[model samples]
Target: MATRLQSKWFRDNSRLQHCLVSDPHHVLRGATGEHVSLIQGALSILDGSRIADDEQKRHLYGPTTENAVLEYKKRRRIINLLYQTQADAIVGKMTIRRLDEEMKAQERSRSHLMFAVGVSLPEPRMVILSETANRDFVGWANQMVKLYSGKVVKVDAATDPAEEVKRIRQAVNTAGAGGLLILSVGHGVCIPQFGEQGTFDLAPNAAMRVLGKNYNENEPKDFVSPYYDDKPAANTGLKPLSQKDKDERDQTPGAQRRLKNWALWQEVCKIFVDGKLSAVVLLTCRIGGAPLFLQKIAGQWRTKMIAYKDQVGCYQTASGRFRTILGKDKDKTAPPPPPHTNTPWGEITIPLSMTDMVVIDPPAAPKTP
Candidate 1:
């Protein structure tokens, strides 16, 4: 089951420059270093454009990387079955060796949808984050959009959410037909009351301007989502929120914003005139932990979701394998596979399509007129 991918980037074309470590030393998700680069490099050569960046030297295991791992494991049936029932997507002994097996040969090519669309609009007031401070994410998003979103449409996620929705609908219409894919980038947040309905912060700052600064900012709402399953899973330690818990979180800021985004998705969902958009990729962090939230949001968009369940960041050391300029990774060429999967925590989850979130270095941004 070796991947059909063929590339010279793979070391010697028979084996990776670095080996995928065994258990304990296994490279799970949330990892960053040279070892990760090795894994990403191999996958890139083995899987074609599937990795986020074809030459992902950043070496951070984000959603795209995690999904690739899951896909690789699934295709090769690398599950041990002794410990876990299904492919967990974590890069342990079995997973790595399986990926290694494909390093030696070349075969068919995998076709992917490079036409996904991305929509990101943070509060207009928020400054463009130091592009370097969040380079890993910025780069990931930039690359993912570039590689997968062959047809790019420009929309500001304008301060007026309603307008943003209108613009997105227009993008979908003009982008042509087929499975529609979208990337929602920016801050992701969760209210304990709706922990399972985790939402993003794309609301305009104008909505928050009138709210008092000293008021209870952590209070919860009575909000309930149709797709949210409050019942805890049979054995998962996770529990439902009590009234006290909800009260504590209701005062939080951004509730309206999250709600607005929720409504916005409803509108976005309705825009599926041709077919369900391939998937709504959430480039935000930690949303994957809330499966129910994903379900609800996806339901709103009438599509599946791909999201992460952790604080997505790559490491940067003065002498680290992945160096940074100012703060961004110095090397801007490369792609990655998807991630450390969901255990008590989570990896990027693709409810339907298990693997398709690779990220290669994106072409430079176009000059704005």
Candidate 2:
């Protein structure tokens, strides 16, 4: 396992270094059996570029060279040695200096260190009410954030929710790191905005009603522009549009705009809609907790935890799964009797690496009708 991990790490680092500074000729001659074809293709491309110094090119890609020779031998394929000898004879010394320069030009693009900040939920009521749940979130988040010098702001848990959200949003926008990691862990529910449920329909006039011709963020007082530009005289109770039309209107700019409510789902949704997040890990038990903001960019990667019971606490099968939860108590005491209440409980899950295990209570599931 250690050997495999080390090799994987080396390969990953090599790939990273390649992205940072790649030699075009080194790239041109990559495989063992494909040497002839690769060389022909490279020469065709290089010939067009007017690359001078044939000897340098030979050393760069020719079969007699160390890299090409090794690559050829690795494939267990031996071909015309006369062609190799002929190329070696005509080629001069002195490796190409321009390819090295080109490689150096791409150095800045190969950064691996990443920084991210994640928030479970920005609402105060939900976090404070669920203390154990909050601990789980804090423990898991702090562990992950330590890798990147990042911070996790518990909005509802904090003294001032508004101030915390503001600070968090600012940090997220200015992190200036490789990628921003954002998590919105909480319950999710859809609301009827203009009587539409998950409707994607939008019209030009409805769009204008929601977003306006020239929307300005500078106008703090005029935060939400009125749905209607002009109201009819006196007894005119004529609605602006049908519920379906109004739904379309609400869906337009409101879909992109900052949410009006401070719901847990909305807080998580705000992070994605704000448009600074690179990767988001939703810890909510249910799907569709947060909209897919960076979905296509990251594809299908996710942080999933599966729990199983052991002697004391539950254990996760994946490596380093329960490490965060298995912490040493300052004063370890004898285990207390299990709760007497008829609580449908689950065991505490810890990683397999740890020696000690402890029991913990999970948040009670809501009773179904």
Candidate 3:
């Protein structure tokens, strides 16, 4: 688990030694890290700039950092309340204090962090959601990071899946007894049934590149932008995992513990946050394939959960409405079943929204005459 930025503040912080402040006791231009990096971090949180967290370059009060400081002060009206003046473009004492206070509150709220598939949703929009989900994830997050301008940690869970769990649990613990609506978008191995939801065998993730859009910090309008990173190739279809390698990894206890929900979300909910979440929608493949899986999960959670049992895709309409489409689903989509309380998988609900999303109290099957 990462230490909250506020925890990193306070007197005698070892990292604080990198940057220094003068008589006015504020961080300004030309000064580099004694705590300039930390100042940049706080400004990023306060103003939602894509400032690099803890990097050496972030230690300098560059033009971007200066602008962020100005924006943050303006937003908070961090004027010298005593003098009733306007905000300025400096990390003075008031700005630092305000940043610290804001970050403290931020760490205690619902926050977002993600790494996208590519930078943006691909063109034509016929591609499977797996290819585009991360793009949306990154896009939504980018928009959110700026709009809300909270403490957003930009990291790909692929490198440190455990870290994500820890971070989530910490955020949940600090959210002050409020329910969270969670939407997770990514690829998952389709589960045929409930008990067979093996996390490891299902753990392989689609290749993840750097922090997306070449680290584009700006929020997007329609989640559509040119890919600054390596664009995804056409659907060559997934290469099957070999049996021997799968067996070996599954046998390892440690590997099983680090299960990826791109198969089952239970590992994180049960182990980390203990159901602090209210609603969870996993936009992965074949989640609805096993009705019993969601049934078991719903019994545990207080709020609703939703998921798709089909290999989903994002389709953009001619009028520019981007939504999940039934046309793209080839095999993973389930067929509509007989009218009953127990919803059978297959037969998609038609023109679904956003990456064959699933989870929640699915509508009860209608009563047959």
**Candidate 2 lDDT by residue in tens digits, 1-369:** 011112111122232234223433233342222222223222322232222233232324343333433432334333336455322211111112222232223212221111011112221111111112444444544443442232333222222334444444554444322233333223222222211111110111111111221223233222222211323354556765422244345655543332331132234335434543333322222122112211211221221111112111222223333222222221112222111110001111112211121112222334799
Instruction: List the candidate 3 regions with Cα displacement exceeding 4 Å.
Output: 1-133, 144-158, 170-178, 183-185, 189-267, 270-275, 298-303, 314-369
Best by TM-score: 1
Q: What TM-score, over all chains together, does every model reach?
A: 0.41, 0.28, 0.32
Rank ordering of all candidates by lDDT, starting from the highest: 1, 3, 2
lDDT score for residue 268 of model 2: 30
Go through the candidates in order and give each one's C-alpha lDDT: 0.42, 0.26, 0.39
Stretches > 4 Å off in candidate 2 = 1-4, 7-133, 148-161, 189-237, 241-281, 287-320, 323-369
Tens-digit per-residue lDDT, 1-369, candidate 3: 122224323323333322223325566666664366556544543454765333323346677777777877788787877766787786655665556566555434423111011111111111111122355444433433343433322223332344444544444443323233233335544345443241111111433211112222232211111122123454668644432235345745433332232122344435323534444445455655555445444544443555565554443323332334332433222232111111111111122322344445524435799
Candidate 2 lands at a TM-score of 0.28
Judged by whole-model lDDT over C-alpha atoms, candidate 1 comes out at 0.42
- The model with the greater lDDT, 1 or 3, is 1
298-319 per-residue lDDT for model 1 (tens digits): 5444555655554333333232
